[model samples]
Target: MKARSFRFFAPFAFALSFSFLSAAPARAAGPDPDPWFGKDKALHFSVSAAIAAGGYGVGSAIFDARGHALLLGAGLGVLAGAGKEALDATGYGDPSWKDFTWDLIGVAAGLAVAWTVDLLVRGTGDTHPLFTAPAPGEMKSLGPSGLRVVF
Candidate 1:
């Protein structure tokens, strides 16, 4: 039963991720033009880490297996990143392997961090960061200026 459900949920989750990637807005070049956009790399990192940690935690809990959870979390991260890149390649946004790679790294790092923290805490608590919704009127910049705005 668990195996069957795992298979079902995995694909469903991937599909949902793909849908989200397809729906993400294209990258714009500028100060985001949005007043609410926070031009902070820390925020992006935090968001990525939080999502990854959550993925790891949920995977761990559902599978009751660390290896399986790690694999699933990494696979999901890579798939989601690649899917997003593909969507961006459609001229709707910027398709960047760099971004995908970094995202994957972030996901892996987050998962590792969560696992380590969990172990250190002796499984008594979780250290997964809470996910936060982006604010409206957010804009992201693209390119070398290290400008990527999000709301």
Candidate 2:
């Protein structure tokens, strides 16, 4: 009986002691916080740009379409940003729409770069793999092309 009684009162005593521990008083209302330049925003942009470029490159290689690559990369980038914000909302950190906006902008810029490179690779009218002509003075025969495998 004594053991059982102690167990019940022991929890109550612990809870009562915890109730006595007080937190610091809240601060008086102040001016709105100023927006500052954040390094984290820069990192968010750069990392998103790199990831978007890679995603576009790989998607372009697999799909063989610039528009498809843009869609795939942008969609993924936005989804990733949204997911990150959602994770932040879980109380680990403060979430911001501005960060996601920067991500979207970076993704668009990176996808544009990927598209331009793809165009350069594909060339205007040539279907050949060779990006450039042999020389201005010499006429060269097209060499055998190798098979490309994409996954």
Candidate 3:
């Protein structure tokens, strides 16, 4: 009973303490409450970008359509950004839309890069493997000395 009561009241007590602390007089000189290009925002952007790129790779392997893969990557990035903001909203950290915006930008950039690389790998044509097959009857073998051809 005692432990349960403590657990229940602890959060309230903690919240009340913050309220008291915040009640202190403000100073004239201070940093912005939330800057658009802060370190935290940069972290959010980079992490979202990585998530998007990874999602794109996985999606590309799973889906034959490039558009579908792009959608999956974008969806994953948005979900990650929103999830983080949701966590912040739950009193864990400062929640700001600016961070979400940066995350979105990062997602776009990551997707663009992945798409470009995919295109480059596929060549000018649609869905071509990186290595093209040699002409018939030209045997190619892999040995200790690397690729060897027997004409």
Candidate 4:
């Protein structure tokens, strides 16, 4: 090929190559489009974590063992993460290993949290808010029902 002919196709070749290369990583990283800090990773993490927590709750309700619940939670987390990745690979979204990595992290965190709560509530299993109002009989009229404080 002559120099002039090659020169004519140089821009087109460059554009095509650039187009293909650009899609290597930035597939569907949400609005930011940054593969590293994309919202997709966050979504993956949350969804997997929720599924793990749900599994723990269900297993705990049905099984008599805490460890069994934890194990089932971990298994459900793994399955949910893999299912999410497989769904993404169907062209509905960009499939990313990084996203799945975050999902695993979320699963571990969720498991740890559920385990802690289970242990904490083992004896009483009573959950209550910090503040409690007195009954009508015990209610005091010593001061205003509501007070406004100025900063």
For every candidate structure, what is the RMSD over all alpha carbons to the true structure, in angstroms? 24.5, 13.6, 15.0, 18.0
RMSD of 1: 24.5
- Tens-place lDDT per residue, model 3, 32-82, is 889987888889889998889888888666544566668889999999999
Q: Which rank order by TM-score, best down to worst?
A: 3, 2, 4, 1
Task: Give one digit per residue, the lDDT tens place, for model 4 in 52-93.
Answer: 888987766544456567788989998989887899899877
**lDDT tens readout by residue for model 2, 28-134:** 98853423347677766777887788888776655543555677788887778788888889977778877777778778888778777878877543322223332
lDDT for model 3, on a 0 to 1 scale?
A: 0.79
Name the top lDDT candidate.
3
- Per-prediction TM-score to the true structure, in the order listed: 0.48, 0.58, 0.63, 0.57
lDDT of each: 0.61, 0.68, 0.79, 0.72
Name model 1 segments beyond 4 Å from true: 1-46, 122-151
Report model 3's TM-score to 2 decimal places.
0.63
Output the lDDT of residue 23, model 1: 98
Tens-digit lDDT string for candidate 1 (1-151): 9999999899899999999999989887785432222343344345556677877777655443355556666676666667767888988776655566566666778888977865566453222222322344544345568765443
The residue pairs found clashing in candidate 3 are none
Residue 57 in candidate 4 has what lDDT?
77
